[model samples]
Target chain A: MTRARALLIVPLAVFVGIVVLLYSGFGLGRADLHPSALIDKPFPDFELPTLAGEPPRRSRDDLVGEVRLVNVWATWCPTCAAEHDELARITGETGIGIVGVNYKDDPNAARAWLAERGDPYLFHIIDARGDLGVDLGVYGAPETFIVDAAGVIRFKQVGAVTADTWRDSMAPVVASLQAAAP
Target chain B: MTGRTVLGITALCIAATLASAASLVDAYDFDNPALEARYRTLIAELRCPKCLNVNIAGSDAPIASDLRRAVRRMLEEGRSDQEILAHLQDRYGDFILYNPPLSPATVLLWATPAILVLVGLLVLRRLGSRRDAVELTEDERARLDALGAEDP
Candidate 1:
């Protein structure tokens, strides 16, 4: 009887183990948080119009000179609005440059949004048709990529950049890339 | 209506429905039948990055549509299936492929089913041998023989 009970316990333990593993997997925050394929890869070449409309166009060459955050945003994305202040704060506090990609948004609406809510970006790349966004493997808006001085993408944050995300996750990456810059 | 006429009408309705559904999913025209077939196969194989579990062929998301367009463009450009898939994989990573390539990270994912089967077989073999090893004691054998004699 004791041996039979022990054998039963083996199956029960296995069941419990699988449940724990699955539970932990689900608890790891957003299900969409998969690793970006562009990590350590050179930023995809693009020559898109800037949000200001004065320079008319900017290319990958302009972004290569500094360690910066390439943030994908659109006026339609509420999460981008939510993180707008945090982005401004990041640049103010860390002195890091941010380049925006106005992904798939109306240029007028994007410019109006920036005017109302204080633009933190050094310059905004107009990805009006999401051509550059597709090249960057962007599935959604408000995704942020940390690009090194040499134009390599070091890391990517899929969702909004909250204060906690900035302090804990993105700040360290940016700092390390800055430290390693030639 | 006559039964024959009704049957013909029903068959026509079914064909029309199927043709509409096919056009909805695959709106792009291909001059070559082989290229069209390849397009179908590729879309079915590629997962929609924006949607959960749905392949690009089944997903109605904008990104899925964009990817489908890319596939069509590449197919028309005379690019091989491998080159087209590699292009997307380069951008979207292994997640876009329903059938993940075998790599060090994915070896366990591909191997787990076989491992489980092997372990199950080993456990079954051990249990079978244990049952086979169970022999009757001398007293039990004597009782069995007595019962057998009485039965005869």
Candidate 2:
């Protein structure tokens, strides 16, 4: 081909290539934004004081021997409040145990909020400093992690747990994990 | 009528904002100036996972503050910079780093600009080598006229 023709082809190919690259970037198709570092691994080990007046400490060891959900929530997080009823329904309907991490929230406010909304958590793991949430790779509140009987994280939902999410992802995984275990 | 009061308030507001920004860096004082400088640089290197675009140093997000405290704790314990980076990476993945390591996934990100530049230079050289439409020489023109007369 002539030099001019080849040069034209070069610009066209570069433009097409960039277009393809950006188009495929959207192929994830609405999966939660953050790429979790904790999926398929054990949820980070943490022992936090309970929000119900501190004597009853909750730890990773307590979560073992059962498939359960660990939810990170705080009174300050509006989305957490919105998802509270759905969480309560999930807890009531399905027998899946849920552990709550009250991340970076005041103990009194957390207790009041949970009390007002009706506490759905099996136990509250009060994390006032967010140290435990950091370990769990929590950038925002309302993240839920599904742990297998062996304490391995099977799945993580990065945003609020709505009915659709519970039905589509969490419930199915929880059911299978429960069935897989004794 | 109350211009002096408004001016006083403006000065106080500016002072307050400056103090707030300063406090972000000052809250956790390092044992030495070198350690403090490193802390500042490290926070600047890390992103606030919740804040999206801002670095952890400039972000007021609670998660950013938490990560800052973690970095401080790690530094105080004599952990190396690589160790601290690895720890955050293990928890937050490569997103935490402002400059992620070159890996298979990021090859395009690191190489695309270089490839484009090379293509541009090659195109420039190609265009440069072939001199501007070699001014049709006098002999070539005479030959073209002879060929045209025969056809006529």
Candidate 3:
């Protein structure tokens, strides 16, 4: 082949390869790599402190023996701010203990954010370094996980913990866990 | 020209070609400081389709440039970072973000790698057993030894 034709074919071949790779799932996009459906599996183990001014961490032990909604949030995350009101309302209405995992956030900022908005968390666990969040496979906040009385993870919501989500999706899962005898 | 001069001229032509082929660098211009900072942050969080791990802000790929332009346009229109990101997600699907939206479509993608690994393991096991079973026949082994001896 002539040099010009060879050069043209080279790029064309590369473009075709990329298209094939995309079709075959190599470039399937990061959104395709989300494991949000393993809702009913056991909750991953975690340990973190509550905000400094607030009470000490309530531990994974405290999480057992009751259906709880664990929310991973950070003061820095914009979505967390958006969902704060919904969380407060859910706590007030459902009476299902809403636990908070303040993933990789400043303790002072977290306390202030909660103070400014209203702390809906029954007890906030400070995942200051994001170690606990990693265990939960939390890519970002505000993510909510529902753990049963037996500590089995029954549900997970990847984004903002809104009232609609709590009522429509989370509440039913929590209720089922409540009705079942340990 | 003599052979050496011809070779030197060819080298100069190659150098000139390389210089002309080099891509131009773009300088960042921020009209609004707050908007620019937010734009930078948003772009940094977005994954480039062509360069996968390198974010739009960091990548020089054409697709990244297009995404950066889109981000700037959205910011200039007074859209918040969330709104801009949502718009991008809508246009490109959740793949635009480094952290993808956890939806039904994504659940399958997340599970597929593990499933592929499992399937591969199963295939390997079957192939391994077949390989073990299809050991060289005595005649084939003798022929292989004869071929090796001839090569030596």
Tens digits of per-residue lDDT for model 1, B1-152 = 99999999999999998876675584787899999999999999999998869999887788888788888989999999999998888878888999999998799999999999999999999999999999999999999999999984
Which residue pairs show collisions in model 2? none
Assess the local accuracy of residue B15 in candidate 3 as a C-alpha lDDT between 0 and 100: 92
State residue A47's C-alpha deviation in candidate 2, in Å: 2.4
* Tens digits of per-residue lDDT for model 2, B1-152: 49999999999999999888876653885678988988988999999887668899888887889999899989999998999988888778888898989999789999989998998899798778777756788999999899999984
Q: Which candidate leads the pack in DockQ?
A: 2
Question: Quick one: best TM-score, which candidate?
Answer: 1
Q: Per-residue lDDT tens digits of candidate 3, residues A10-47?
A: 76897999889778885554433444334556676665
Provide TM-scores for the models: 0.80, 0.79, 0.48
Point out the higher-scoring one by lDDT: 1 or 2. Answer: 1
Off by over 4 Å in 1: A1-5, A8-10, A31-33, B1-26, B123-152
**Model 1 docking category:** acceptable
Compare the candidates by lDDT and give the number of the best one.
1
The Cα error of candidate 3 at residue A19, in Å, is: 10
Interface root mean square deviation per prediction: 1.7, 1.4, 11.8
RMSD of 2: 7.9
Arranged by TM-score, best first: 1, 2, 3
**How does residue A27 of candidate 1 score in lDDT?**
68
Please give me the DockQ of candidate 1 compared with the native complex: 0.48
